[model samples]
Target: MPASLSKGGAARLALLLFLSLIVLVFAVASATAIGDYNIALTTVFLSVTNELGLTGADIPPIEQSVVWNLRLSRALIAALAGAGLALCGAILQALLRNALAEPFVLGVSAGASTGAVCVIVLGIGAGSLSLSLGAFAGAFAAFGLVALLSNGATSGPNHTILAGVAASQLFNALTSYIVTTSGNAQQARDVMFWLLGSFGGVRWPDFQLLLVVVLFALAVCILMARSLDAFTFGDEDAASLGVPVARIRLVLFAVTALLTATIVSMVGAIGFVGLVVPHAARYVVGPMHLRLLPASALTGAIFMVVADIVSRIIATQQTVPIGVVTALVGVPFFAIILYRARPQA
Candidate 1:
């Protein structure tokens, strides 16, 4: 697809984005309402509106508290995490020209988990380094390792995927070793649950932080959308077309690291939003980054909020790890991609 959209295409994209926004709002509300203690959908709306000072509707204090204090934050964070991951996946797919490129597949999420464990268990930097910062460093480290193993960005998709698998195993094992050797039983339990992914510990502060990171990253990516479109062809083609290939790649890699690290720090290492959402978005919006980035963000937000809801209800009185829910959906999608990409007989 061309970087620029035709007039009719642009109008269709706008309509799609507008409709997706509405769906995202509904998805978030549904997520907020369908927890262990059910809150009515109307109550969910009034609770949110009341908090915003938009209405003075009478709502039960407990319902209000749950909606405003707990579920709302989690839903918002889930939305942001999904959007961020999807954006990372879209950007990476373009930069690498590989459909399977994403944070989870690239081992960025595992690397971030290892870094977070370093802070929580080993107390890396002795109380100076924040978990997000540590994860950012570790994410980049993993990226660097993959780059080395695959012989830089020019490596074939199979080689890159192999490098990512190696990185994931290495970081996951390191995380386990650190917890087992340094952490107590209680800490071990907490770390293990977190590594698998959870939204239970998040609050408004987390939502606020993630909101900023995701929105800022989206804006940056949007501005670079044309460059990303150029990248889909090849680095040589991109360079020939006046794109500064090296700088754009570095900046985008940094953005991806920042997003993956922040999300892993806050919500643990959730997977597959990055892998699955972008492809789905591209199906809807076509492959232009200008349209695809926002489409991915909206689609991702909806997908994750729905996943979070499933995690709550899938077990009797127990919340499955959000990662597990995503993996269930993602693993099938992953297999499909692999089969489709397989060489013809």
Candidate 2:
């Protein structure tokens, strides 16, 4: 690399870091001050402190349970889901040569949601492990359909998304038939909120598991940044340049499926993070995949955390669904981008 280009990269990185910090401070402050659904941000922070034995005053075990087991778990889970979605979307857009591509565009989320509903509505998950396994299977099925339809990597962008759409419609139809045919009022309620998505009812073990999964996904995204950058020049071009296109695509898809399934099983099908955050990050950092990947990951984590905070605070005594909050935030931004994007030459 030229000396000037190296210097330019450093300057841009510094600017990204400074901007990210400002966003983080605002997110922490907003999360700390806003109140409504149940507890204020200060209370949430103090509760965390109390759990860690860092608080000056002694609080009851119940208080610790409430903060650590429920709220904090939800916050972290939201962050994990967001980061995973955004990271995957960043990879997919480059790989597919499709600007409209997103992590869920291939119906992985729909398939996972279908599988989860089967468990929730059918009393299938005897344990948490079963739930995760089931969701992963469903996500894998969705991706499998895509791969097969594409004839093991010969398929184009539209063909893959089309395959995903067809599979999703089938899953949705099955899900609807199952729900309607079962005629179980109790199960219907579970399915409804699961689709709406919330961080409620989490435990300490689940929280730890979410943290580990997210860290692993983040690591993979960082390591694969070079491969993603290779994708910018188009697949054939990259291949001529000695990039192993098929191998990299397979690896990315598997990692994304794993990450997406892990989150779906835990947090349900929260929307917009994967679809919105990557684009926003690109707007911030331009189209350098190496930087874009990590930048998107951070942007997504913060985006969901803030959205979750707002969801908790928007209503008195009742929490809004985080999915709804995400859609509310993402839609307008998406529209603006669509309007502003230039025509491809």
Candidate 3:
């Protein structure tokens, strides 16, 4: 755990993540082409090379369908969701100046969950992306509350934390009331399932939606990373260093909330990818968002992929939600982190 070795490890992890993205892209392609889950990485490599302007022959129709129609989209969507959530956690941690700060932990996820449940139970979503829209509304409302509470002379990380705690409790109460009042077992189960999160039942079209959001969110985060880095020295120091702390936070918070809402709608509120992946990345990678952003994204992508594999392998026909698996796996890992934890940017 020497400083030099930590840097080297991070560099190695970054490289591995870069390669993994390429590998995942190829794997998704092969999965689509063959219509089976047994395709190995080598086949995927050949398929991708052929697709690129590299040295390979024309891919057959089956291969094309596999790569373009089915597996590719689903896998990419999962990657995007994982990456987006991790970045969201990283940004929130910085803003709140608390390691535990995350959409789920701070009640943003709870608020979104409540809004989504209302639509599901009351049939208010009507159809379309109503669930997602409701979640976004809930997330924004929570962010607004936090913003309001953090705007005064007494505002600070602690204030935001307190406000977020209150918001979380309020949202959960509302959600419980709705589920209980409805008195339908099915509705109650749906609400509970969503709260735990998942990426079950995803398809190509859904993946397409995921792609648009992930890219947009990541682009914004990269643009904002430098300012986030400024926050390492505290808000006053960041302000002195030319950062409009409040303004930047508002923008990033909105973006993160939107990203979270979109992913929640699509994947059903997968947690810990954001909360754990960034901390994991930060352990090996430096805290600089320039490095941290991509590392967190890549790490999260790999982590979720692996988690999905675990969920799939351990299932009883019905695939376990990826979110549940992540928490079960993350609890031990996070416990270790807490035992040996220290402050870092």
Candidate 4:
């Protein structure tokens, strides 16, 4: 443990964790309550308890279905996705030593979007695998290409970022061509909604899958906390500290790409949670990965749930895209960070 994370700092971190947990609970409850059906908090509690077989509150089937099958599932997925993306961002920043690096910086999101668009618009891979499968395959493909182009993490972060940019542009162009040439209004609308992100049809299965992936990835990251700290001082410093720089960087890149692809496959490219949440967590907990990772995950979860709730409330007849809500918030937040980072006059 670092000296900066002294007893007092530990205590403060614990307190923040406690408060964030409380807020997460409240956020989930509030999200369940808000919606077209307008479930009461008591009803939401009762419904959840009933579903868990803890109580026999005779809630109506319609209400029970809405609360359990719809709102709760979506909220859980949003939280999981947000946590996963934020974790990816934190890891990427550490791995690449670039503050601007995020899960999608490797063009994984673009690749995933292209894969999903292929499935939705062209009906490719429609029989055996689903849209998510296609998206993951595409994301991995993009990441593999970027890794190959960048010489397998041996070159430098700058080369990796450039490769990612090129791949992203290529995939984005393919996605645009597919959408424009498809000429199906319905397909185009569906693809657009997905690109912008949504949690409308999310269910327990999707939530469970994301939960497993996030928990597994998070555990791996926590175990690598010390090595990540070493990476902060540069490859030479990290290597001197016995960190396998190349191997660790490669592994972390793959992990981040997989995490990002999984989430994008489910929820579309909901940006900024990855880019901004880690920065916000660093502001609160400093740059130590041991503390930063979990803090960022919690903060991201909270942000995503709040964003989803706001999206639902912003429109009565139709829900706003989750991506739009996030971008609307993230753009200004990103600007503020950049402004603060500018050299003092």
Candidate 5:
């Protein structure tokens, strides 16, 4: 309602959203059929149906475990994490008025890496809560430091970027130092793999936590869509439109940080979903946040599920890291965007 859309445009938007959702569902189902075991699509469908109590299809225990526990959980995490990251990226770009802003642009990922490194390498918290707690702490710490150094959310994007860069460098250095000096070879390998990201070890519990967080974040983002529209014009313009510029900025930042931290804790700093998916959605839907957010979430979920499938298939004996796959795909897209965004000579 904020932005006027012609009937044709609205219909097109609806079609796009519909198509994106279809793609997302297909991606999830297909991804579940991928991996080393290669479960049949029929089995995947039946197993899901049986679990939901729609029908009692007799399935082998091992296949049921693989489908329900391993593949489904991994697929769900990939979907939710992708959605959350993309949502955060869209929010950050709007909040900062910067095209390049993303979920990790503010050092939250680096901080998370540092925290996870501490737990894994130093044995700092050595229990169920160790990794997640450390990651949340470090993420919030980095965000707080960035806010302080940038003189809070009112300091503009440049200052915030600089502060984030500084914090990122510091946390990244700390992670590196810990890995190089204190960690054993196994710990080092684990840390490196985690930093690069993976979904190999995810299970129902992890998926459940991520599902809740991502859904809650999405709801909050959708509620704030109108305010995000006001923000696109600039701080003064938004304030004139009755938007509380600073307060909204703070809320957006906190939500993004919390979402980023949760995902990073679950699956170690997977990159570029936040960056690439939002830009892609914006291109399709224009600058309207209301349309862009859902489109971005769906696009991101599809992208991540596909990327996860690629990661599994890229190597027979060993899985490729999700971060590596994303980076390989995202870097070229980013370059193209930058090139196109540049002024014509």
Candidate 6:
């Protein structure tokens, strides 16, 4: 859908996407096969088929349980989370006209962290509230504050970014205060770990919820792809081209918020996937939103699934947080982006 892409370019793009999907499938299968117990790929396939009722190959109960109840769900969730975050990053970058824009830039992650800590440390909701729900509320609360500070979606990009910084600091401080003052040592430890991100506890339910959210968000973004392309030329240019800048900005921002909040609540604010994946995807797919969005999602999915696999085996008898793995990769890429984005001498 890129205006500049010719027939040859389209063929290349299609091939690239096809290959990416193949790699993603392989990465996911690898994830399901390479845990502590290390099931074979054949067993993994049969276990999956067995669960789908597509085949009735007899498998050991424990191995089947590990694949079905544990690794498969975690891998799928990682893929979805990656795809969702990358999509949000792409959306924010175009709307804000900033190459560095990412989901956490709006302070959503910080707010989710504060909300989660409140649930865990303060026993909020009198034992009725789930951590995910609390974090969701907190994330939206941060979005609300940023919206107010920046005078809603119509504010200049710089103003919105500044508001996001303020909101992040405020929520981060609140999280620290609650953890330090109210939570006991064990509670503090738990809260800290969750904030670093994990796929350890996710199951089919989390995957299902995220699949729906990510699919819906991707569909919405694809529908608005042309408007997003218009926005890259600045709001006035978009308006001149008959794009409804204000309404589109509001809708896209809300969509990003929905995605960021949902993911943070589920996985504890994994970083750099959103920041790094979109840029890499743009390089491969060019700057068109139509191609860029799905490409970014696919790249993000592969990146995260691989990251999850790396996290599992990086240390002897220990699991690194998925966030930590992403940070390790993203920080160098972040510096490269910054260096390239520096003002020309």
Number of clashing pairs per prediction, in order: 0, 1, 2, 0, 0, 0
**TM-score, one value per model:** 0.90, 0.87, 0.81, 0.96, 0.96, 0.97
The true-versus-predicted C-alpha distance at residue 173 of model 1, in Å, is 2.8
State candidate 6's TM-score.
Answer: 0.97
lDDT of each: 0.87, 0.74, 0.73, 0.90, 0.88, 0.93
Please name the candidate that would achieve the greatest TM-score relative to the true structure: 6
| lDDT against true structure, model 6 | 0.93
lDDT of 3 by residue, 19-138 (tens): 867865644443333332445455555665666668565556665555545555666677778788888888888877777777665567877887888888877757765776787777
Candidate 6: stretches off by over 4 Å: 1-7
Q: Model 1: which residue pairs collide?
A: none
User: What does candidate 1's lDDT look like per residue over 1-345, in tens digits?
Assistant: 443778889888889989999999999999999978998999999999999999999998999999999999999899998889899999989987889888766778888888888887888975789776777677778877877887765565567679889998999899889998899988787777788789888899888889999989999999899999999998788889999887787678778877887888788888888999999999877898999999999998899899999999999999999999999999999999999999998
lDDT of 6 by residue, 1-345 (tens): 556567887788789989999999999999999988899999999999999999999999999999999999999999999999999999999988999999999999999999999899998975688999999999999999999999997888788889999999999999999998999999987897888899998999999999999999999999999999999999899999999888898888889999999999998989999999999999978899888999999999999999999999999888998889999999999999999999999
The reply for model 1, stretches above 4 Å from the true place, is 1-3, 123-137, 140-167
Report the error of model 3 at residue 156, Å: 1.4
Question: Regarding lDDT, does 5 or 6 come out ahead?
Answer: 6
Residues 84-129 of candidate 5: C-alpha lDDT, one tens digit per residue: 9999989988887877788998999999999988898888878765
Off by over 4 Å in 5: 1-8
Ranking by lDDT: 6, 4, 5, 1, 2, 3
* Candidates 3 and 6, the one with greater TM-score: 6
RMSD of each: 2.7, 3.1, 5.1, 1.5, 1.5, 1.3
TM-score, cand. 2 = 0.87
- Superposed by TM-score, candidate 3 places the C-alpha of residue 5 at a distance from the truth, in angstroms, of 18
Task: Give the true-structure RMSD of model 3.
Answer: 5.1
